[model samples]
Structures are given as structure tokens and as C-alpha cells.
Target: MRPPDFEARMRAGECFHDVRMLPAAWAVLRLDGHGFTRFTGRRYEKPFDAAFHDQMIAAAGRLLERFQGLYAYTESDEISILLPRGWDLFDRELEKAASLSASLAGSVFSIACGEPVQFDSRVWLGARDEDVVDYFRWRQADATRCALNGWSYWTLRKAGRNAAEATAALHGKPVGFKHDLLRAHGIYFNDLPLWQRRGTGLYWERFAKEGFDPIRGVAVSTIRRRLKVDRELPMKREYGLLVGRLMDGAGSGDSRRTA
Candidate 1:
């Protein structure tokens, strides 16, 4: 009945429950909004909302700053953070990383939106740089697919189709069908903002800052790092290259449209 004996007995119950991220591999922490569909209804514009987008970006930025992530990507209701191979946050405890990150992101976004929100987080492991590149490419593809379906569905809804009707109309439709549906409504799918299709990316960049050297009575420039939010990300092979460069520590100064 001693306190130390009770503590040891309780610890034994968690022996196989806790998991850790592999130290030699890259860890991508992906946080997804829970129950956002019901939450966003009537509160945000259909398909997309600029204010909500900004809130997501704010949450992603906080994650990057707190964890020193190599890169961050957000689309729809989810954000994915890329942690370097050597990252040792929480001693690479998977549960700690996921729980704390989800809580932090939910808190940051809730404060920004003036309403409580929740995100569920998970850790993805990549064994190599190419694996990392492929993972992002996959996510970008999912973004574009979701964008297309969203526009198509919203177009129908605005044109008098009910929720069930809109869902049924595009349920078994092909990609071409969705594209044509949007085009018929005077919305060109390809011409839509790149961020809608490819998702937004955030990474650190170094830039020169000018300041007065008061002690020496002279103006001096120094290098500083800032988190760059990219809205217009590249596609396909180019997108892969961007991820590769980021993993290799050459992401700064890459050309892209920003918000």
C-alpha cells in the first residue's frame, strides 16, 4: 500500500500503450479539424472562406514556431507539419507530440475565430527525403480533388439543388464531370486560386534587415529569419522539388505567391 509501490504498479499498465517516433526517420504531424463540417455551416462561405483560411494559417504558424518544423502545409480543415529527422521534441514521444500539437492548434485557432474548435493529430513517418516528397505530393493531390468536388457541389447548391441532391449529383461522377459542371456555372476550375487546389505552404526564410548601429553611428544590415506563408504552391514535379529543397535546407528564396 506504499505510494512508490502504487506508482510503479500504475506505470506498468502503460508499458505497451505509449509509442515514439523513430529518431532516424522524418516525422510529419498532421492535425485535422474535428466536426468542422457542422461547425463551418453558416459561419463560413461555401467551399472557401478567407477569414477561416487566415485562422488556419495562424495555427500552423504557431506549430512551426513551437516545434521548429521544417515546413507546414494546410488545406481544407487540416494542417501537416514536417519535422526534421533529428527533431527530439518530447523525446520523440508520439502521444505527446500528437496530443500537445492538437491542443495547441485547437487553442490557437479557437482564440483567433472567437469560438472553440478541435483538431485530432497523428504522426506520419518517412524514411527518406523522397518519401517526404511523395507524402506532400499525395496531400496536394487530395487538396485539388477536394477543391474540385467542393466547387461542383456548391455550384449545384447555389443553383437550387438541395444538400442531398448536390451530394447525389456528384457522388459517382468522374473528374471531367466535376470540371464541366464548374465550367458550365462560369467558374473555371483551373483558374481558381492556386491555394484552393494545391493547399498553402509555410517555411522559414532568411532576409536582410536594416537597422541603425547606434554605438558605431552607422546603418547596418543583418540577416533574420521569418515564416513565409505561400498560397500559390507549384504542382506535380515542381512541388516535389520544393519539398525536397526544404528537406535539404535550401527552401529559402523559392519563388511563390504569398499572403
Candidate 2:
């Protein structure tokens, strides 16, 4: 969460243990092509990465203030979000966000990519508002998996591998993608998550054995690991926004966990 007024929330002394159940949450994924690397390589080669970067940042700021949720922008290709419970019109809001992202990105890289764009496709994962913080922590892992899958295949293709060859390499990996689709002007999955830093995912647990419900001990460990993520996830900004909203009632000693 961003700089929160924990002291003020705690001063009220409301108990979080027995608070009423929170509403369901909706996930919104924002996808975009990366930067200006491809354009520079071929044509003018103007060191315009900085200019494009600023465009993205400004567009992000404009978009965030206009929407609601656990919002965050990835420097690379996507923004992952969460809508709090009670936001009855959440799905509609999500579509609006998608359109807005596409419009903004298109304008920013119009000359280079030759098109304004956001994600080619998107996915959604639902969660409860109360578990929102942990949800993102889990999602970053999943998103890392998603972005890595796409990037790895793209790398293979760029290195002279074909569709068949790239697909084979990404099998059993985190997030899978086709190499040809990602070879646009500037974005690659690897560039965003820096997969090299995280290494190939280990699949710490597979859902099949227990399905939606996990074994108690393992669940605790997973939650603990997610809650303690020192690294930033795509939803941190929105997480802060929601937490700040909830602080209205939660005491300083409320259930909110400080990072």
C-alpha cells in the first residue's frame, strides 16, 4: 500500500477480526506493446524511448484518476487491477479501462508501432475484497508467469526459431504465448518482468490435487509468502486506494497489514 494514514486508522480502535464479509472483486488486466526498440532498430533510430516513456506515464496518470480499483501500471506491457466489492458496475468499468488504454497507447507510439494499442488479449481472476492484498501478491507471481511465457517464445523466434520450435520451449512454463504474435514494434514479455532475475517458475503448487481449496498448512505458507512480497506487484497503487477507503472504519489496530 502507498503511504497510508495508519496512525489515524488505528487511533479509532475498531476491531477487524469480526468485521462483516466484504463483497466480491473483479480483475482487470491492461496489456500494451513495450517501447521504441523495434522502430529505432529499423528506421530513424532516434533515442525516443524517453519520450515514449513519458507519454506512457502521463497516459497512466490520466487513466488512473479516471478509474477505480486496485490500479497499477507496469513499465513494460500491462496493468493488472482489482475492483472492490459493492462496485456494482465493475465489468462495464473494466471494458472502459481497456478502451482507454488502447486509445492512449496508440497515440503514444503511433509513429513507431504504426498503431495505437494495448493488450492483444486479456484475462480476469476474481477475488474477495478482504483478501485483495494477498490476491495481488499471488497475481504478480501469475503475471510474471504470463509475461515470461510470451517473452521466452519471442526470444526463441528472434533467435531463428520457428512457431513450432518456440511453442515447444514454452510448454509447461508460467504464461504461454505464440512467438509471431508478439513481434510487433517494441514489446516483448521478457523485457517487462525481467524473467532472468526471477528464473523459470517452479510451480510451487498445482491446483488439481486440492482444487479451489488448498491444504491448510500449504495455504498458510502461500498466503504468508504472498503477503510478504517485498517486490512491487501491478496492483499496489489500487491496493493503497482501497485500503485508504477502508481506513474510514478500521482502527489503527484494524486488520490492515503494513508493508
Best by lDDT: 1
Q: lDDT per model, in order?
A: 0.90, 0.43
TM-score of model 2 relative to the true fold? 0.39
Task: For candidate 1, list the clashing residue pairs, or say none.
Answer: none
Off by over 4 Å in 2: 1-58, 68-70, 83-114, 118-127, 173-259
Query: Residue-wise lDDT of candidate 2 within 41-158, one digit each (tens)?
Result: 4543122234444444444444433444334344434444333344444344444545555665456456444654443325354554545455544545555554456456656677
lDDT (tens digit, per residue) of candidate 1 on 1-259: 9999999999998874468887789999999999999998859998998888889999999998898899999999999999978899788988789999999999999999999999999999988788999999999999999999999999999999999999999999999999998889999999998988889999998877777777777777766678999999999999998898899875433332211
**Which parts of model 1 are misplaced by more than 4 Å?**
16-18, 212-219, 251-259
Q: What lDDT is reached at residue 69 by model 2? A: 39
Residue-pair clashes per candidate = 0, 11
Q: Which ten residues in a row have the lowest lDDT in candidate 2?
A: 199-208
Model 2: residue 103 alpha-carbon error in angstroms: 4.9
